[model samples]
Target: MAMQDLDPSEFKTQAPDAHGQVSTLKELGDEMKAKLARLGLMIAEEAGAGTYLQRDQTTSLCSTRSKGVEVLPIRQALQRYDWLKDYSWVAVKADTDKFTRDAASAPPDVVQGYFVRGLKGQVERAPVQTCLYVESRSTKQVVHNIVIAEEGSEINIITGCLAHGGIGRAMHEGISEFYVKKGAKVTFTMIHEWQEQMEVRPRTAIVLDEGAAFINNYIALKPVGSIQSNPIAYLNGDNSRVMFQTILYGKGSSRMDLGSRAVLKGRNTSAEMVSRIITRDKADVVARGLIVGDAPGAKGHLECRGLLLSDTSRIDSIPELDAKNPDVNITHEAAVGKISPDEINYLMARGATEDEATSMIINGFLSFDLSELPPEIAKETKKLVDQTMKGL
Candidate 1:
């Protein structure tokens, strides 16, 4: 069906449960909207027309696992708000056949908002089953403006994008503007997986305010083509902090570009970035990190590591530290190589096949350090990563 034909009104919005319990989708969307509206009101009251001028740009695409799933076009949900006309962000998910053929033939509504529009409280979170296929073949773009309001308010968002069939190409561009008044927190998590022929490129920008905290985590495994992502965070408020972590694995002919960055502009601000990448077969992987301290008492740190399972596989690491303040503390570390021969030999002596040994070692490498996550999420993430590594 054409994107324009899929009416948002047709999708039933269920009422609250008997006890006034909010459904998953409604609760998420409403919470995001409330926060966004609060920030919009503040901007309108404080800066008047000038508040609208500071919006950011974003664009994105996804095409690896599109199959027999309902690919909801974001434009439908966005049209509900008039403020979106000034900025644009577009995303599409579908299977290979539908994406390459039907997607290309779909009406212009599917591809509209290429460069102009703004998005607010556009939140979607759901526990997608493994069978729902989504694909993005054509190039996609998005420009987004995100704002967060005052002390004690918080916004938490979670999303899982997966493909259970065929392969395709996808891209994403995102920008977030945060106005953290006094003390507030925003936590976001995005997880992705694709078939052997998919390619994905995702970019993000985040701005932080005083006494606020931001935590973002991205996990990508078993992509058939190439997966590249850039996550940037700007700490513009004193005593604010940001934490970012990325985990990725590539096999077959796949490649991955994964990294995170933070810029500290206020005193007592802090940032941390950690990453891990695994490459097998003839795959190539690159992990980059950067941390900048721009104000007195600001602090930053970064670490990245890559593991190569095959002699022909390749891995690269680029870590940077830029500091303008003498009192600031910043550090970084990078490593690129393979599993130790001794470790492999030890596993082989225990009667494990080379492949089995390699898989076990690789799983162990990615399993550690997830202790901080809630038990349920950590368990699910570990299981998913293990399943993805079996293909290697």
Candidate 2:
């Protein structure tokens, strides 16, 4: 049979089967909701979107919820705010069924996302938030969100992912696409908080127009069974800018392979990729970053840092840069090692126990300078970041 002739949903481990057996647990109650809220999402809970999804008794499936009580689909959630009406869950099954490169132009319905309304030359005032919660057994879920900032406009978006208790092995796959038009700026922040047994895969891509800017921030503070992802950004127009910042903590027997790639294809384009990884227990982690400059006057930098908390844990940093233009500037740096005992001793000498001293060092290392983000977004995400650092 031809590739196009097969059943599109048959291979989907997260999609509904012939007998409609997609959910591992038939329904969820208050207990699971509380669990989801406390698992590194107290900020989201305070914002009233902690458990952004819930199960409807009649359907036995999960749906996006508003305020923990009102059952709302992503479409309806988009309708709540007039400013969000321009956005939607536009990706089709074609986008999420596979890891194809055409996701930005041809998105499948299986993907959940929206298209931001572009302003000819203005900034959007409201910050968009996409909160998701998955609590099903034998479940595999995929999310694909698209954002397009019109020329001369600016916008901010925050994406949060969470899974219910570790009942069985559950999976979540995600894809995101961003189109920054000429002179536009788009800032995106991703927060992943899943249980120990869940698996996650996130695929993201971005395209920038002349003078456009794309800022990406990623944080994973909890232990997961496994996660593998690589997000790519393309600076295709003159003077475009793309920066990626990430912080992760991998624990237990988890495995994490995360990376970011930037292609500077336009004159005077600039890019940066920074990542920090901390591993504990038997976790295996890799931090990968790459920047390619193909245009004259393009400049880019890549950096990766790691901290090993357990002797059996492993952390690897990979940084790469490819420059085709002699006039361009590109550089990369990577470092992986255990926390320095000298740093801990210094803190301990200042009136703290060994545990407290170690905690302080770990927290300081894991904490990021939010000054890199937009004012509003930085202010909002700082709380979540602080909570994550302390909890870990």
Which candidate number maximizes lDDT? 2
lDDT of 2 by residue, 1-392 (tens): 22223222332333322123223221345665454334333333224221233221112233222321222333344556565433332222234445333333333333343334445665653444455556567565655455677788776666667776755776665566677889998877878888887767667788898999988988887888777788888899999998888988888887888999989999999998888888889989878888899999999999888898889999878788888889899998888898788988898889889889888887777667566555555765666666766766
**Candidate lDDT (C-alpha), each:** 0.52, 0.66
TM-score, structure 1 vs. true: 0.63
Tens digit per residue, CA lDDT, model 1, 271-304? 8887778877887777878888899999888878
Count of clashing residue pairs in every prediction: 28, 14
Give candidate 1 misplaced runs (Cα > 4 Å): 1-150, 167-182, 344-360, 371-375
